[model samples]
Target: MAEREWTTADFDYDLPPELIAQEPVPERGTSRLLVVHRTPGTNPPREDLAFADLVGRIPPGDVLVVNSTRVRHARLLGRRPGGGPAEVLLLHPLTGDRWLAMGKPGSALRPGKQVLLGDELAIETLLVRDDGFREVRVVGADAATAIERFGRLPLPPYIARDPDQLDEARYQTVYADREGSVAAPTAGLHFTTELLDAVRARGVEVVALDLEVGPGTFRPVEAEDPRDHAMHEERFEIPDTVATAIAAARGRGAAVWAVGTTVVRALESAGEPDGTVRPGAASTRLMILPGYRFQVVNRLLTNFHLPRSTLLMLVAAFAGHETTMQAYHHAVARRYRFYSYGDAMCLI
Candidate 1:
């Protein structure tokens, strides 16, 4: 029989606005964790746990994979000619000095127009996409240097305030490196160096990969049928060392715990048809819907996602659809924090 069809509604839930966490917790490792067993079928298939319990919960000798893509300071404020303010949010970089970005006040972005960036640099619009993004080229400075010097961190829309110094440090994971992503791999945000050291000391093998997260992370799924949604493409790279480690772990019957959904996408996207992982760099637009086979990720540590989001559907596909939704409702009823800077869940 064909797999049961799923709609966008099947993955949605009601959330109180107050439950949407607007600020990060005081300490990196202090957020709450809800543990969900994928096989359970009762009223609630999850149990509440503290983030500190993670090291003890994960099985010894299991391999843990994390995404180390750094969150670039991609949001920049500038001025259009005749004194109108403009904002440029970088999506992905192209050649050395060009970027695919979205500019505010569309009128400020006609081809040949220049947005004066603060660091003695400027960007000239070369093309406007039908989707309202612009293809722009830096005029006087290296794109990377300009961004690091003057651009602000790009916080999620729900954050509700301007980026501050605290946000620059707190918004990224301790392991973040090789900068490119517009958004942080949030589930990784809960871990600090101390926490990671503890996890490693428990005999769990820890490894890293890069998945340059993009705006698609926050965009709501608009398709009526979940399968019709076009997944966003993000760049990823897997080293031979990490690939061999994961293969060895699976060969020994050890669990492969993905630190975040980004890691899940990176691993599953790199999986070969024979269920082995390939080591290489490429872009992936892979979407995980119900009935899809999971090749490598055996456990997931992820943040609660937005209603009707592609992320919600992904978690449903990993865990059972009904069981995942029940756990979400249970989380909401019990006042768990939601979204980036919110709480997390470990589904096994």
Candidate 2:
């Protein structure tokens, strides 16, 4: 049999609109977990479990690397000088207090215009790009102070709801420290303090890496040819402590597991061609596709991804393409919740 070309359609799967979780489960660690076994030509049955049971899946001495990039209140609500509603999502800060962001009703906002964000909060457009993104410098207060005062949680668009006070806590992971991501590392959101302690009690080590997931993470892949789509660049850092932990795990013949796709990218980005992880901080546009060799991550714990998303492709690349699709089929058949605030999958 000839090998199939992995196109965007190949990664697509049917999901019911109602199955997309609009709200998070009230209990953080009470969500469902589906364990998928990845092997060539093996259609292994999915194991049903709860999030709290996750630690048992990892073997002793394994190092689970998690992304500690916190989700900021990136959604800023305001009005144009003409009194029209304007929404902005800060992507990442650039040099000289400038930021790259995407704004709603962007067609109406021209370069050299100012948008008023609540009382004493405003932004001046520095440049408007062909892609519809704006490079703007916030006026009045600095970024951090302004975000705290006027920003809202940048929830996934599929949720079909506005950010609430509860989302400020429920949407973030317990271990999140550094703030930069516009979206939550959904997989990590399942981990509670008790769960982390339990994992440590079972001899599984936890390590942290930083990957500032950008606004592009939420953008759907619109290209027919998956490979033709350009992956967005996100800043990532693998601290020396994390590098040391991974090296120590390898030294002990232990598997290095990634908590989410963000961790997978960070670990893979820091890995040398020979598969050794080096200490480094850099921006990665590493697009993980089928036939790509994974050097660092031995296992992945992630949430169900959108059809035709780069996230789904990364999971397919980590797990076998056929195995991943089969798992997705099983998930859909079982009516599992999909996307952010959805059920999880652990592939080993």
Q: For candidate 1, give the lDDT of residue 124.
A: 87
Error of 2 at 190 (Å): 0.4
133-201: candidate 1 lDDT, tens digit per residue: 789987888787778777899999988988888888899999999889999999999998998999999
Each candidate structure's TM-score, on Cα atoms with residue i matched to residue i, is 0.96, 0.96
Query: Given candidate 1, what's the lDDT at residue 19?
Result: 95
Tens-digit lDDT track of model 2 for 210-261: 8998877777788988878878888888888888888888778899999999
- Kindly report which residue stretches of model 1 are placed more than 4 angstroms away from their true locations once superposed: 41-44
Tell me how far the alpha carbon of residue 141 in candidate 2 is from the true structure, in angstroms, after superposition.
2.6
Off by over 4 Å in 2: 1-3, 40-44
Please give the distance, in angstroms, between residue 224's alpha carbon in candidate 1 and its true position after superposition.
1.0
